[model samples]
Target: MKIVKSVLILILFLGIGATAWFYYPHYQIHKMKNDSMEVGKDLSRETYLDYYRQYSKQDIHHLAIGDSIIHGFGVDETENLVYKFSNQLGHEINKTVHYTNKGKNGMTSTGLNEMIKAGLLDEAIKTSDIITVNIGGNDVLKTAKKQDYYGAVKSFDTLQETFTKNLTEISMKIKEINPRATIVLLELYNPLPADHQFSDLADSLLPKWNVNIYEVAQQIPSSIVVQTTKVINSDNPQNLSQDGVHPNSAGYTAITTQILKQFSKEYRKEAV
Candidate 1:
């Protein structure tokens, strides 16, 4: 009887330890999110635009590429994030901002790399002063859907590895086409609601993928990673479209704001 009781106690302790390990990181993530919200609230579009007006160039040629987010899936043409970004950037700098959108509805990192390798985007890339890339979400979703939770988690390492390799090739191709063009890579945000079954898994794996993005950006000159996780998360259903997979108008606006903020920072850094 005592032996059975001792085994049960050990099992209970192990369960408690696992629970703590899981919940502790989530708790910290929650706190960090709240802090980020506070910081986001302080910066308005006007604030970023004002900074840009002081240091920005008089003209820009922006090229947008990647997946559905760049294609403005579930949103109208006018509500597209790239369109809004280009308009706002032009207005702020009092310049001509010509933009070309080459976004496909279901593009993956591998697809993008393949397209670039085929020289399909070479002309646009060569003429563009700015290029924005939004990819890897579809890649993650495809892997997650095809496997169990643990299986998906185990597969993320390989997914990220493949993504890193593809993205590096894509960046190199773009830079080879236009070394002067600045590449803006947007980090993927969790689209699952907090109470959703896959939310925790997404939250756990997304940062690892984003770290790959950041590391890739660091390798390529004139490239930067724009963080979207803080600005666009499952906390606000209104930010997402009916599909809950893509951003709504408001969400795109938020993303545009973040992108512009990065642009202003880059210009300021260059001016220094």
Candidate 2:
């Protein structure tokens, strides 16, 4: 009994020490903000890759794929959303829930479709119990509307059709990869006011695009859609970055919070 107690105490100390070693530098880097590499210094890119390598050996659940939004544009930590959402799900389910963020900046559904066609989807979907995606923002915004009012108005219809087709293809590809994976697609956030007249057109079209996303999500049998339009459209000043395109730190936190809430619900149901 004494030997067992000694071993337990040693184990406890080791766990505490390991936790501090891994997280202390990361905590300090976040405090600075300008240098992400400094914030992530303790875990080098090699270490980050190593960690993922280790995680792949375990049972994976809760995978994510998308553009810079899931890549955490303003959030200091790359693992910020992925870790938080996974932990929430793991706790609620009383089972190990692993998350992988397969997010790339400036990627549209066209890029995602290409990745799927190229067989890159296996990295995310092969072992995932759930998969979440966000796309179509870039596809809708690819065409630069001239300052002229007529040009912008004329481009809207073409952009709308392209957006719909690309997203539909992305959704279909995801379904093809893993039929059993619980797929969820996060609708695109509203773009900031670019021009007086164009802003109005964007406002009108944003909701319509979100509606299309909802319609597409419903078409998949075991799928869900999480609408972020309201959160992004809120009057909170901290919600947008300086460029007004991506979410600011506060906005990213809000988005993470919403994802965690949904993950908790599904995870809890699985636990029962």
Candidate 3:
């Protein structure tokens, strides 16, 4: 009877551990979403742009590079985040925001690092006043769908290590090329629907992946990490395209707003 009681106790402990394992990620996600919503609340866009007007040039050269998000895949040329961001920013600051996009479909963090090292983006990086990076979605998606949860988690751990290294190298290299340019790194958002099979796994891992992105931004000068999880998640299915991976025009607009808000907040911090 003592042995039976011991076995039951062990089972109960294992159940509790399993519950915590799943519940903790969801808790992190909730906290992150709340924090994202609070960002830039003290500063308005008008105020931020007014501050920019004081220090920015009459013409702004914007360079966007990364995967399909940067490339404006699954959306019209005018509807992409880059276009929306430049247009709105230019109008607000009264500057000519000329942009050159080097976004390629299916680009990964490793590929971006290789390109920067190979000097493929030298001229663009050097001449740009602003640069936005949106790579890593492909990296996350590549490992998030494994059939075994443990296997997927292991793969993501390996991927995160490589991704962090690559992102750090990429940001440092870009800063080396253009010390004055502001680098905006977009945080990866979970694209899986809440009801999807891998949704829980994605929720479990996305916060960690985004943490790496944030850490790299902190280490690099003139770098900003823009949070997109609040605006681009499974809850907003209408924002996504039919493919369910890429954002539609509306989704791009939401992302562009987040970028502008975060950029302006950074500006406010410096001005204050």
Candidate 4:
């Protein structure tokens, strides 16, 4: 009995030590990223000026909104989806299109709706010919990550309801601002690979969140949902950045391809 108790105590201490060793650095990195790297609620005055200013210079405009993926968090402007999407789209349309990114890191669906209410996207939305919104990832992820497996799924219903209402408002607001423009809402992708610790949670939760997005898209005219499942999983080595969450250049490329395909399909339908 004494030997068994001693062994158990030693195991507990070793387990705790291992856990702290692994988790402490991760915690610090998360804290640092939260503090220094990401652009938060304050959309800079310069970015605003540039957005509206570019509108006057171009006949076509593409505005991006939502989270870090849309913002191209770690990557440069050239490698970001918004930039690449605009360039490639411009080629197909045979016209120059200026792109504006209003995507902030860590933005949620409710945050997007609030930003619209705050008039952050007023003039840009009013002038944009194309608007691409990538939202809801953080919203569901934040909620899902907190709960156990079974509980996490059950919690989705409440979030889906709120997400539906918030997303519908966002779409409606965009339509009110520019009734003629095309809107593309990108679907949420599971960034965790099967090998990842969080893969099971992320894989199960993301699709449920995307279903709400697609259903909302169906309600809005001149809107479409682009498939992004191919890019979000870490199994696709080209898909993720160093962080393994946000899209890398190749992942952005894949997303842009899908968006452009959707745009082309919509354009043909409209032309008919």
Native-to-model Cα distance after best TM-score fit, residue 250 in candidate 3, in Å: 0.4
Q: List the residue pairs that clash in candidate 4.
A: none
| Pairs of residues at least 3 apart in sequence or in different chains that clash in candidate 1 | none
**Residue 89 error for model 2, in Å?**
2.7
The prediction achieving the highest lDDT against the true structure is 3
Task: Quote the lDDT for 260 in model 4.
Answer: 66
lDDT of 2 by residue, 1-272 (tens): 99999999999999999777545544543332222113243333322223323344345577878788777665666435565566655555456777778888888777887887788877678678777788877665554533344554467667667767777777777677777666767867765654445565566556555666666665565565664665676355467788787887667667667755543332211110
Local error of candidate 4 at residue 224 (angstroms): 1.4
> TM-scores, in order shown?
0.78, 0.66, 0.82, 0.72
Clashes of 1: 0
Which lDDT tens digits does candidate 3 get at residues 150-176?
676778778889999999999989878
Give me the overall lDDT of model 2: 0.62
Tell me the tens digit of each residue's lDDT in model 4 across 1-272: 99999999999999999777545644543453233223455655122223323334446888999998889999999999999988987777556879999889988889999999888899999988789998887876677677764565677778778888899999989888888676878877877668877676665556556666766665565566777875566668677888877888888998888776555433211101
Q: Could you tell which candidate, 1 or 2, scores higher by lDDT?
A: 1
TM-score of 2: 0.66
- Each prediction's whole-model lDDT (CA): 0.78, 0.62, 0.80, 0.73
lDDT of 3: 0.80
Instruction: Please give the clash total of every predicted structure, in order.
Output: 0, 1, 0, 0
